[model samples]
Target: MKFALAQINTTTEVADNLEKVRTYTRDAAEAGARFVVFPEATMSAFGSGLRTIAEEHMESWRSALSELAVETGITVVVGEFATTADKVINLLAVYSPSGERSDYAKIHLYDAFGFKESDTVEAGEEPVLFTVDGEDIGLALCYDIRFPKLFAELSRRGARLTVVAASWGAGPRKAEQWEILARARALDSNMFIAALGQADPEVTGVAVPKKGPTGVGHSLVSDPLGKVLNSLDGAERLEIVELDLSAADTAAETVPVLTNAKLGY
Candidate 1:
């Protein structure tokens, strides 16, 4: 299957961001992508403030996303800010070609970014594994990458490719952490990893420090062997790569690494 990961910059303008998503969805469809993924909070970049997020609800955002899914005839996974009865949460909306929807909330929040995401958002404890074109896939957010057990559970539940939708800041240390950790997760779990992040001049006006590098925009696709299949650097990108879940079976049959790594549950 052809998969496209969208790394676009989003701000407070929900209409503008939705338009951009539509354009990218059309582009991906024209390019023959069967599935398309968007970055976290693609609708509107609610800054590190709680009031900003609480004010934005999922009702308005879901309508546009559902419309886009029906129009494109492509499986679109979009991340946005959602509010429940209790608090706001980072959410991923997985829409099927027929307009069916499934959601996964951000399980782990990024509290280190001078933002109290957990305080404003209720954390999700369950992991989600959904199907696309007969392939089982996993869903995760940015900070969730730091947790291996979550990915392992999805893998055990038959997820061959885990899509990480994130708004990673630009910074050398953070970028390095993301890169190494992503590849490691792919290698250890023996599954393909599609990680997409946002670009510089973040929607938030905080002005990410030049020294920090918020996100160098090197969105990548890695195989089970920890090999980089394709990548993009600088600016927003829509990368389409062929995801062959059968390949994972073949690799595991030959190496059988996962077979030996017992979890002792």
Candidate 2:
């Protein structure tokens, strides 16, 4: 199956962000992509003052995404900030071509690198694993990529592809860290890894003027053997790559990492 990684700039306005998503989804679908994954916080700005969409707005967003999926005949994995009773939840919503929807909350909050994501966002308790076109896919958020155990658990659950939506901040060695973590996770789990990140010059708000680049947008895909199939750097673009599920099976047979490691769980 071919997957498209959409590296886009997001802002506080839901409508504006959805428009960008629509454009990319159409483009990706036209390019023969079976699935398209967007970066994290695509519905809102990724910062200390993140905004959550109201219940009504959330429903509207879901409806729009469902329509997009049905029209394009492709699956879409999109990120958004959902409002809860106590706080906002970082969520990834998966929309199938048949208009089915599933949501996955972020399990690992970004409380590192001088940012306290846990202060406002609630962590999810379960990992999300779903199937599309006979392929098992796992969903993870930004900080979740840094944890190998999560990827291993997904592999154990029969996930051939793991998708990570990230709003990775830019700093010293942060880009390198993203690439290393992505490759390591794919290699260790013997699965394909699709890591999509938000681009820089972040759209702060509806009213605020856009600034220069800030976020790191190195969206990439790695095979089971840790080989990067395709990657995008320093721009908002669509990257499409065909993934072979049989390669993952072959990698597992050769390395036998999952079977070799004995775990208490």
Where model 2 places Cα greater than 4 Å from the true spot, the runs are: 48-56, 202-214, 263-265
- In candidate 1, which residue pairs get closer than 3 Å at backbone N, Cα or C atoms, i.e. clash? 169-214, 169-215, 170-213, 170-214, 170-215, 171-212, 171-213, 171-214
Worst lDDT window (10 residues) for model 1?
A: 204-213
TM-score of structure candidate 1: 0.89
Model 2: lDDT equals: 0.84
All candidates' lDDT scores? Answer: 0.77, 0.84
Which candidate's lDDT is highest? 2
List, residue by residue over 1-265, the lDDT tens digit for candidate 2.
8879998877767799899999999999999998999988887766544543544477788889999999999999999777767778889989999989998999998878777888778899899987778888999999999988899989999998999998787788999999999999999999999999887553322332233123587788999999998888767889888877889999999997888887742
**Model 1 lDDT, residue 73, Cα:** 88
Error of 2 at 202 (Å): 7.8
After superposition on all C-alphas, the RMSD of every candidate to the true structure, in Å, is 3.1, 2.8
